[model samples]
Target: MLQTIHDLYDELERHRVMLSFQGPLSTDLITALLGAVERKMEGLEPDQRTRRRVFNVVMECLQNLFHHNANLTIHEGTTRTTDLPHGVVMIAQADQGYQVLTGNFMAGADVERLKGHLDRINALPPDQLREFYRETLADGTYSNKGGGGLGMIDIARKSGGKLEYGFVPYDKDKAFFSLNVNVTN
Candidate 1:
């Protein structure tokens, strides 16, 4: 356990991580993290545009985790337990730019749906991506979770890059979804 913890710490340090969080992803927590990140970015980077881009991407990432994290309920006879919305996020800086990474547990069945969405977004060129973003926005459609389905598009637009994502099986019916977005400074 000690070695594993040390290895994780060393990896973050090597990546120049500035902030990280893992726990129940709530609106209040997101707001507080935004503030903290704002201050940190202000001190680290002088370019306001770059800071804005990084902040926007981070916000979208956290919001996705908040709205999409799976709630696992285990029941056996009269015993039951409800799991919280748990996720992890890390913000790191490198010579080229800032990277915002987030991970959360999700139903394994949803992997293909998410993969398809991400693949479509990533395959579009910048111009087409912008058009798609606008078209989706004007459609006025939203998921039951109150998301307009434009978050990923906006994140790609703001970050000026493709969204890198993957899924790792966490259990027979669950997987860990991870996403990474980069903002150039």
Candidate 2:
């Protein structure tokens, strides 16, 4: 365990990671993380517009992590909020700009649907993507999490890039879904 953590730290440092978090994805944590990232970027990030874009993408990703994360096992007699919805988020600075990576456990049944959704989004041109965003918004449809693809559409719009994603099977009923969004200044 110690060696794994050490390796992880080394990899992150090599890539100039600015922020990282794993475990519960809660509203409180999201608020704190946004604050922390803002402060950290003050020194490293020079462009205010770029920082805003990064913040918006991070916010959307964190919301997805919070809303769609599958429930984790809680110890008997423990409160639900005590465990939180397990997820991971990391931000790293690269040559172009910043990369936001987020992951959360999701039901296995969702993998295909999400893959199709992402593929469709990726296939869209910028103008059409914006149109789709508006159309979806006007449709008044909601997923189980009360999102009408707004978070994802916003992420793509803000990032100015395709949403890259993959799913690793966690068990018979669950999979770990990972998403990557890049924001270039």
Clashes of each: 0, 0
Give the TM-scores of the predictions, in the order they appear. Answer: 0.87, 0.88
Steric clash count of candidate 1: 0
Q: Which 10 successive residues of model 2 have the least lDDT summed?
A: 70-79
Q: What is the model-wide C-alpha lDDT for candidate 2?
A: 0.89
Residue 96 alpha-carbon offset, candidate 1, angstroms: 0.9
Alpha carbon RMSD to native, model 2: 2.8
How do the residues 74-98 of candidate 2 rate in per-residue lDDT, one tens digit apiece?
5886848645788889999979999
For model 2 the local lDDT of residue 70 reads 69
lDDT of each: 0.87, 0.89
Candidate 1 lDDT, tens digit per residue, 33-136? Answer: 99999999999999999999999999989988877877634355542223557889999996788999999999999999889989999999999999999999
User: Candidate 2's error at 140, in angstroms?
Assistant: 1.2
TM-score of 2: 0.88
